[model samples]
Target: MQVQKFGIEALDNMLGGGLRSGRPYIISGNSGTGKTVLALRFLYEGLKMGEKCLYIATDKPPHSTITSISDSFGWDLLSLNVMDAVPTPSLYSTVYPVRDVTAKGEIREISEMSKNVEKGELTMESIILKLELEYKEKFYHRVVVDSFTTLKRFGVEEERRNPVMAKFFRFFVEKGSTVVLTVEGNIQKIRPELILSSGAIHLKREVQDMEEKRKIAVLKMRGSFFDPIEREFIIDKNGISIRKVKSK
Candidate 1:
C-alpha cells in the first residue's frame, strides 16, 4: 500500500512511516490546537514531493485569510491550487464565478455553475460540483479542507450532511487523492465525516504540571499500526513539531 507523509518527522514515524495514500483522513481538534497548521503542513509535504495539491478554504476567505496565515509560517502557498468556497454576503449575486488562486498568484475565474444560487450562497452541493469539475480536468494528489465545522454550520442542511459528505469522500477516493479534513471539536464529538474517514488524528490542549500543552494522538487508523500514544507537540517559527510522546 502507498503512503502519505505528514511532513512532521515524528508524526510520520508514529503512523509507522506515514499514512496510507488515496484515503480520506480527519484532523479533529478544538480551537488553538493547530488543526489548520497541521493540515497545511501536510500539503507542504505534498508540495515538497512535487505533487499536485489543492486546498479548499471553507472556513475563511482564501485571498486574505489563508494567504496571511501561510505568510506568517513563511510557507509560500502560491503553488497550491486553492478554491475559495467561503460564503459571501447575501447582497452579492448567487451567479458569481468560481475562482481559484493559481500558481502565478492571480485569481482566475472558472466556469459558472449556476444562475440562481439561493442568495448567492455557497452550498455543499455546489462545492461538490466544483470539485467534480476540477477532478475531471486535473487530478490532485492531496486535498485539504480547512474545517468541517464551519461548513456544517452554513453549507448544508443538517439532515443531508452525512450522505453528502459520504459522496464527497467516495469521489475523493475515486480520484486517488489523499485527503486531510480539519474538524473543530474533539474525538468525543461523533461526526459523520470522522466515521467516513479512513483514519483520524486528534489534537488537543491539556494541562499537565500546571502548564497547558499541545498534544496529538491517532485515535484510529484502519489497516495500519500506529503508536497509539498521545504525544506532545509545539508550534513556533517552523510550524508544528512533535516534542515527545507521553510517558506510559
Candidate 2:
C-alpha cells in the first residue's frame, strides 16, 4: 500500500514508514496536546513532497491564522491553499468549535450551533459542498480539517451531525486523498466517523517531573503494521519532534 509520511521521522518510523494513502485518520486529543500542530506538520509534509494540499480552518481565524503559526515555527508553508470556514458569530448564526484551551490553561468560549444561519454564512452542508466542488476541479492529495470537535459544533443536534460526517468521510475516501482530522476528546467515544476512518492516532499528555509531556500512540491503522507503544514528543518553535520510548 502506498503511504504518505507525516514527515516527523520518528513518527513515520513508528507507523511503518507512513500512513496509508486514500484514507482518513483522526488525530485525537484534548486541548494543548499538539493536535493542530501535528495536522499542520502533516500538510507541510505534503507540500514538501510537491503534492497539492488543502487546509480547512474550522477552528482558527483564517489563512493568516495558519500563516502566523507556521511563521513562528519557521515552517515555510505560505504557499498552502487554505479556506476559512469559521463562521462569524451572530445571534442566529454562531460559529462551530466547541471550545479552545490554551497551553497555559486559559479557556475560550465557543458558540452554539445556529438555529437559523444568516445570509452569506457557512453551514455544515455548505462546507461539504464547497470541498466536493473544489476537489472535482483539482483533487488535493493531502487535506486537513483542523479539528472535528469544531465540526461537531456544526449541526443543532447530534443526530443531524453524525450521518453527515459519515457521508463526508465516504466522499473524502473516494477522492483518494490522505486526510487528517483532529478531535478534542477521547478516541473511544461512539463517534460514527471513527467507524469509517482508515486509522486513528492519539496524542496523550501527562504532567510529570514538574512539566508536561506528550505520548503519541497509534490506536488503529487499517493497512499497516504500526507500533502500538506510545512514544514521547516535544513541541517547540521548530515544530513537533518525536522519540520512541525505550522498552523496559
Candidate 3:
C-alpha cells in the first residue's frame, strides 16, 4: 500500500508513516471538532505531491465551503474538480419519491420538497464513475466526502442505505484512492448500520471546567496498525495539526 503524508510530523509518525492507499477511513466528530479542516489538510498534502484531489460537498455549496477554507491556506482548491451534490429544484421530485397512502389509494409523492434535500439526489457510485472518467490517467490519490450524515438525510433507512455506503466504499478502494469520509459519531452510535462497511476514527471534544479541547483517536482500522492514544489536534490558519498525548 502507498502511504500518503499528512504534512504533519507527529501525525505521520503516529500512523507509522501516513494514511494507507486504497482504504476507506471515517473521521467522526461533532460540530467545531475540525473534521472538515482535517479533510482539507489531507487533500492539500496530496495536491502538493502533484496528485489530483476531489472534494465532494453535500451540505454547502462547493464555492462557499472552499472560499471559507482557502483563505486560511495557500491551496488552490478551485483548480481541482470540486462538485456540489445538492440537487436542483427541478430534479428533486424525480430523484426522490416517497410513497404515501392517501384517501384514494397508495401513491408516491415527493415529501418536504426542497432544492437542498439531496438524500436521493446523487448517487456515490455515479460520482466515482464520473471522477474515474475525468481524471483518466492523472491518478487522483485523495478523495473527500464532506459529510455522510447529510447524504443520509434523504429518508433512506439505515438497513437500505448500508448497501449503498458499502458499494461506494468498495468503488474507491478498488480504484486505489485514499478516501476520507466525515461522519457524526453520535448519529452513528444511534444508527450504526454503515459502521461495518469502513474503518472508523472518532474525533471527540473534551470539556473540562467549561474549557473545551479536541482529541482524535482511531476506533478501528481495517487491515493496518494505528495509534491507540487519543492525540490532541488543532485547526488553525494553516490547517489541522496533531500531537501525541503523554501517557499518565
lDDT of 1 by residue, 194-227 (tens): 7899888999999989999998898878898888
TM-score of each: 0.86, 0.83, 0.77
lDDT for each of the candidates? 0.76, 0.73, 0.65
Sort order, TM-score high to low: 1, 2, 3
Best by lDDT: 1
What is the descending lDDT order? 1, 2, 3
RMSD of each: 4.6, 7.9, 9.1
| Poorest stretch of ten by lDDT in candidate 2 | 98-107
lDDT accuracy of residue 106 in candidate 3: 25
Q: Which ten residues in a row have the lowest lDDT in candidate 1?
A: 89-98
